[model samples]
Target: MAMTMRKMAVVAVMLVLAMAAQEASAAGGCNAGQLSVCAVAITSGSPPSAECCSNLRAQQGCLCQYAKDPNYGRYISSPYARQTVASCGIPVPKC
Candidate 1:
């Protein structure tokens, strides 16, 4: 019984570690809130700002993930957001 419990504990620890690693890698260098710079630009008709451009560039690798996110996917796919990205000279990620 003790051995079984030990094995279960080890499995639980491994599962936690694996989930952590996946979360880290899934972020692809962009953590939560990293794209907040683009919020105004995304939600309005105004042009993209310098900070927006910088953040967008920095988070390029995470664009696909962002597009797949339920909350952000809509904004990322909107025409205004696409225009903002284009005006910033950043191509819209195909994701």
Candidate 2:
């Protein structure tokens, strides 16, 4: 009975952690429009708009994945994107 209780407790903790992670992921950040705008600005070498900057700031945590992706890394790593991000004064994620 004690062993069963311990196993159930462990399972409960794991479930809680999983739920927390999912909730965090679902939190507002980058939305479809923001990504499209960012992609356009990055590809065109145009400056990012205020809205784009706001979204980027909110979604900073997800940007590292863009940096890591082979398809997106090129554009995300470009001077224009870097300059726009710097101009926005949004801190880059360390991830």
Candidate 3:
């Protein structure tokens, strides 16, 4: 009985952790397509639009990976990109 209880407790903890991770990812904003559009706009030197900002806020977690990529990182790391993120009120994530 004690072993069963311990296993259940461990399972409960794992479930909770998994749920939390999902919530965190969901809150980070933007689907892959939206992120791609935002990245393209930034690379083109155009000011991000309201939609772009919305997506940026939504996909904040994914941005770090994009920021680290050779093709995308240049635009992601640009001052303009940082400014856009700041303007949108999304906290710049440390990649």
Clash number for each model:
0, 0, 6
Q: In model 1, which range of ten residues has the least summed lDDT?
A: 12-21
lDDT of 3 by residue, 37-86 (tens): 45434434456778878878876877776667554455567776687787
lDDT ranking, high to low: 1, 3, 2
Per-candidate TM-scores read 0.66, 0.55, 0.54
What value does the lDDT take at residue 26 in candidate 1? 64
How does candidate 1 score on lDDT?
A: 0.65
- Please give the TM-score that candidate 1 achieves against the real structure: 0.66
Candidates 1 and 3, the one with greater lDDT: 1
lDDT of 2 by residue, 1-95 (tens): 97686556435434433443354466654332344445445544567788878877876777776566554455556677687777679865554
> What clash count does candidate 2 reach?
0
Find the candidate with the highest lDDT and give its number.
1
TM-score of model number 2: 0.55
Q: What tens digits encode model 1's per-residue C-alpha lDDT throughout 1-95?
A: 97686556435434433443366576456543555556556655478789878877877777776667664566667787788789889888887
lDDT: the better of candidates 1 and 2: 1
Error of 1 at 39 (Å): 1.1
Residue 45's lDDT within candidate 1 is: 49
